[model samples]
Target: VNRSATEIAEAIDYVGGILSVGAATDLSFVNVLVMRDSFDFAADLLAEIARTPVFEPAEIERQRQQVLSGIQVSLDDPAYLAGVVFGRLVYGLHPYGMPHNGTPASVRSVTRDDLRAFHEVHYVPNNTLLAIVGDIEAEPAFAAAERVFGDWTPRELPVSPNAELPAPTRRVVVVDKPGSAQTAIRVGHLGLARDSSDYLPFDVALKILGGEGGNRIGSVLRTERSLTYAASAEVVSRRFGGDFMAMADTRSDATAEALRLMVDEVARMQRERVSRRELENAQAYLAGSFPLTIEAPNAIAAQVLESLLYGLDLADLPTYPNRINAVTVDEIQRVTRAYLQPRQLSVVLVGEASAFVDDLVGVGFDDVEILSIDEIGPFLTRDDQVVSVDSFSPLLPLVP
Candidate 1:
């Protein structure tokens, strides 16, 4: 039970020497909160995590091992596999699609220096935002902010690379696991970010597409087609433009058919006008769900945080629900036609590849590329090699 300092130091040195690199994981607590005098609250905590802090490699290693174990345990999990594949194909070269769980190769490659460098780039005072809401006034809030972040001096952000959005295009990617029992299917295209004004309308429109019980997507996928247990379309709204994905897990034999029908539904909305009933149902579902979603204090905090981070006005809160309520039937259909395109979408699936790959090629995708988990590892890494980790290595061995 009593180990010598040599034993512990040897363990750290051996492990550190073996891996040769260290990791740093900083999960941004993106607080979206609603409160009185929110801006004042933001000023108060501008440097919450940005200020000088000590690096913790021991913690990082602990976390790294924990995550590694989790991924290994989840290797048998079909749902995780499907989600990872969906992000890969939908985002393509973008940061959003980066492998969330670090690949074994990438983890091995990350040095403690890499994490230190990443912190310099991302964690800074000006880079952070705070939004507080409820039972608070603006004046006192500003005073509090001055007390909290008043001396918050500006600092240069680290020179991280950029992730430019690619023009939407069409393709079909398959994760062909032989002898798999079920098929996990996802179909859709890219959409707006948190800051895009178009985001609000697009979000409401997408909700109508699939979010609530009465909307078009929910009605069609679950009730009409009954293709699988459940199917729904939801936009992946993020700091960067996220994805608009429609997904369902169907029997392997019926996966291709389900995919085709979903595409038709997406196209149908684009081509045709929404009927009066569909409009009313969408409105009712959104408005009814709006207040209901914010009953919790945590959500209130999150909302405040979101508004602050995205540079939104406090007034947007009350007006947001109103905007959803005011969306006309034409607006819903127009947005559907404009944003959701079956032809412009990517078809991603995880299951028996034999069942659907040939049929998918028959549909229109001439460049159907079969990808394995290994082939995509680099694209999914979290930090430094976000663009292409392999590029950092020498070309001699690979080419030879």
Candidate 2:
């Protein structure tokens, strides 16, 4: 029997349970969590949803309209626009660059058969893993999984291998939102993979650089210079490469100054080792807060699921604090010098393009291009539109 989206949604809502669909570069997953007494009901609903979504033409068209509307709304948000362009710029043609919900054009072209073919290939017993954590005992949890899925035969999953990413090149992209009050800045380069040996040290270094209270960027830009209220830096990596992103939404007038200070802070990290006190604080922040983060069964299950997905040894989780504590100042310095490439950073700005284009060129950046929100695609094929840095002419001069 075909069920509407509202029917399926109402059934899950009746149990006061949660069901979410998530996608990543390597895989997509469904999650269901409910109270202990409602576990069996939740399991059955999840099984039904997973094994047999109606995928009716009307439902597909309804969802496609919703997704298209969402994409349109996201274009109005500066932070969202910046992130969308940043991902495309960082990942290029890789699958990681592909929008999880697909593009406006792509979504419109998806047929019911396309959805079925994708579901058939990806949603198989062999391709899935189940993790149940709550007040339930191990035996019952195991039995519940078997009862729900035991009859299913494992089949080979046909996943295409990801292509090799090209080397990153430094470029400055400006998405023009005229007369905007603030500029959303994203500056960083390609980062390491999740399984890199230097991940620990890089984490420590990132903490000192911009992890928390009064971090390097925040202290200098916000506290000292009063340029902005907040600033932060983080290295995010996936199965392939990631990007080290430093973001701040500063006043349009202070965009260039804030950018200069942020870049300077990164350069200083490579030149000078963090003091012992800074190192100790970063280690304490990571190690001391570790236990509190996993104080619940759901949190533990999530962590375990992440480990399994990434092929990380679950045994290493308990030793995380020890590894973090063992990081020395030298290791932070070495990792910073090796991985954090300040000169190779791609600067992305979403703001009044006329306000900062000349400023960026004045500050000596190359390959500065102005893009409209509609033009920020994975393949930005408008090389003829890129204004040469040496010959930049801003339409509007900076106010004040």
TM-scores, in order shown?
0.77, 0.89
Scanning candidate 2 in windows of ten residues, the lowest lDDT window is 391-400
Q: What is the lDDT of residue 18 in candidate 2?
A: 70
* Regions of model 2 farther than 4 Å from truth: 1-4, 378-400
lDDT of 2: 0.75
Q: Write the per-residue lDDT of candidate 1 for residues 1-400, one digit (tens) a residue.
A: 3223344345434433211122212125532232333333333222332344344667567767887788776555656766766676677666566556756666666767886776665555566554444465667655665676577675665444465667677877777767887788787888877777777667777666666634465566557777677778887776556788888888887777777777877788778876777667767777777786677655565566556655678678866668877777777776776777677887777787887777765555567767665554543553653564211110000000
Regions of model 1 farther than 4 Å from truth: 1-27, 30-52, 132-148, 158-162, 215-218, 361-367, 378-400
lDDT of 2 by residue, 223-301 (tens): 9999888899887876666778888899998888888888888888878988999999889889998998688765676
Query: Largest lDDT belongs to which candidate?
Result: 2
